[model samples]
Target chain A: MSEAVSALNGQSFVGIVKIEEAGPQGMITLRGDAGAAALQKAARDVAGVDMPGIRGIAAAGDRAIAWMSPDEWLILLPHAQAHEGVATLRTALAGTHHLAENVSDARALFRVTGEPARLREVLAKLAPADLHPDRFGTGEMRRTRLAQVPAAIWLDSAGEARVICFRSVASYVFDLLSVAAAPGSEVGFFDA
Target chain B: MLILECPCCGVLADETELAPGGEAHLKRFGPGASDDEFEGYLFMRENPRGVHFERWRHVNGCGKWFHAARDTSTLEVFGTYPAQTTEPPRDIRDRISARRPGWTWREFA
Candidate 1:
């Protein structure tokens, strides 16, 4: 069996904000009522983590769950265990009004980390979300559009941000980020 | 260029991310209803110049349908609420009344 490579294949651009692929990680789309005890227990049983609350994230070791909506979440795990994780969730959530699907292959993710202000500058050029640390701080996830492409973005505890978009737009997103993160493209600011 | 807030996910979605669902609070007059009632429900629209309630779906954000109250002419948004209700919330109506004093849209004065 051939191993799958990252969407960007370790592509990196060292700039004011470091732009690089976040490696091959598991991405699962989970939909269920997080408030339901049965669903919470089932999620823990399958992903070894609790369901994240509204706009919140719950992490345990290598696994992390990001709240996508009221009844939806995105679970990230080790890439190799993605399929098994989906199967496990399906079996555990059977007969419930819930859906658990593996989207690891369908989506590509990029990590942007550096000074919070500079990082937000690059993202502000594409995404419309207010990236102020006070409003969108650690552990908050939002599914929005980036340069007209759908993306799910979340900030981690370490202040690094993961921006995930469809595989088809991975290259476009990467290229956009590269230019946005360039040293001199700072909007409204020029060399004195 | 309109920005609508989704009550479910609490995301302030831009016009590109949201799909307009047209006039809200419609009374469905289906099968066995009078011709006038059916016509009123299907063809008639209360497109007032001010204080109009509308339905919007956050297609790119949370994929949840919501409601927004705005003035058609001025484009001043009163507020946004969940789509589960049949009519505009009282607070939204009061907000509109306070801004456009004596302006009546549908039912509220």
Candidate 2:
């Protein structure tokens, strides 16, 4: 196997908030009914996190699960364990008609951190999602278009968010974040 | 600035977040279909000025396909529903009826 490197080699840019490429992270895109109890159990057993409800995400330590759509859920775990995670899920859901794929290498992950309102401002400028503190808070996930690319935004904490987009668009997203986070561009709409 | 609700995830997404999928409830015509029917299915669309039903993909959100009923001119959304149904639900049809007074989904030519 070829040597593994993150999409951006841990590129970091600072402006209104710190924008950095996340370390190698494992992601499994499970195409199945997220509402199914069997699927939920399999997800929880693998990630040690509950299968999140629609637009919700639950995480425990380095493992996490998020609802990407009514029929799909995303499982996040340590990079080294991704393949094994797919094997375990496939075995657990043997009779089910489902698709589980290791999407870790197919996507890029990044983090934006400062504070809730600051983080919201950086992301809300690009995504159509309402990032108002009252509307989108921690644990909520939105799969929306960030600029011209399809991306998913997870409000992980009051001061941080996880942004994931296709590997090819890493620079595009990184640049967008950098420009949005420029010091003078702060639009504290949510700070009110 | 048209906002549509995704019945699959129940998210009210902006039109920019959703992809318009032409017309909804289309009866696909295959190899054995008549030429006019196939052409109608492929090329024709109802240009209703009032109530209309159309397909929309919540491409940015849930990534699911859903159907929406709305007014073409005024942009008053009647309702949205899962794309699995072949016809509009009774409630949505009723809502459109109440809103437009005499609107009925026109039959395909």
Candidate 3:
């Protein structure tokens, strides 16, 4: 068992390790009934776009990205745009077979921008989502279990990737990543 | 262990998640209906020796109830779709329609 330690800030905790990997500037999760055609139509009408298909991700302008599912989806956006994006989706899906629950604060986002292969190796340890090019290619998204946590994962066209895990387990997953990175010794946190 | 496939959730789910809807193509008889209608409704069996359609619920998985067409003899799954969706791949729609004339083929096709 690892010894419990306190950080420089004097916060004592168990298994709360610092993540040296890049971190997302922002992220959000949206859950609801994706099968409702009326809700989908409303979302398109309000967001001026339709949600992406399963194993796919679509960006709504420069502000948000909506990932699809059989009965739910997660919408990711910049921190600054989170509130407005949720508001728009809510108003659009009103009075329909839909329920959009905001879970931005519930999840912690991690951004990986350097050493793609190394980052992939670290992620493979805890992610059940297929990260293969054929399956998850650039701009694709998947909702899968990671480190026993439900997560949404996606990669931008630029090859930068983002992974979101529930806040409750973020510290544990961060520790796991830190250990995985120890082998390659390329761990570092993002400035942003 | 009868391997049942679910429409909403793909194959490979526990049978416990499903509640047997009994041999597919059930006919219902009302008070004004005839004796033949009641008998057919109570105990009629195509006893399809080959392929048959079975309704199943993906309770433990997607929780969406749906139907599947499969071969009882060979256990070859034809296809599956959402409940009330008019598109099942195999010709089970024709078989179901042929057995009951008044039944709406469009309803469960």
The estimated TM-scores of all candidates read 0.90, 0.95, 0.53
Could you give candidate 3's per-residue lDDT for residues A1-192 as a string of tens digits? Answer: 233221111212221122332333334445567777776775565445577765566776644445534665566555455567667767776776566655655666665554555555555555643454554557666545555555556676533666666667777655655665564454333212
Model 3 TM-score, all chains together: 0.53
C-alpha lDDT (0 to 100) for residue A72 of candidate 3:
58
TM-score of 1: 0.90
Ranking by DockQ: 2, 1, 3
| lDDT tens digits, residue span A84-181, model 2 | 99999999999987889999999999999886788889999999888787788888888899989999998778988999999999999999999999
Candidate 3 residue A106 Cα shift, in angstroms, is 0.9
Candidate 3's docking class is incorrect
> lDDT by residue for model 3 over B19-63, one digit each (tens)?
656555465688999999899888876556555666776543345
Best by TM-score: 2
Docking class of 2: high
Worst 10 residues of 1 chain A by lDDT: A183-192
True contacts kept of each: 0.68, 0.87, 0.00
lDDT for each residue of candidate 1 in A1-192, tens digit (9 for 90 to 100): 479887889799977789998878898888877777777887777667777678887788889888887888888899998899989888877887888888998989899987666777788778877766667777778888888788878777444778898988999999988989998776632212
Residue pairs with backbone overlap in model 3: A20-A188
- Please list the residue runs of candidate 1 whose C-alpha ends up more than 4 Å from where it truly belongs after superposition: A157-159, A187-192, B34-36, B107-109
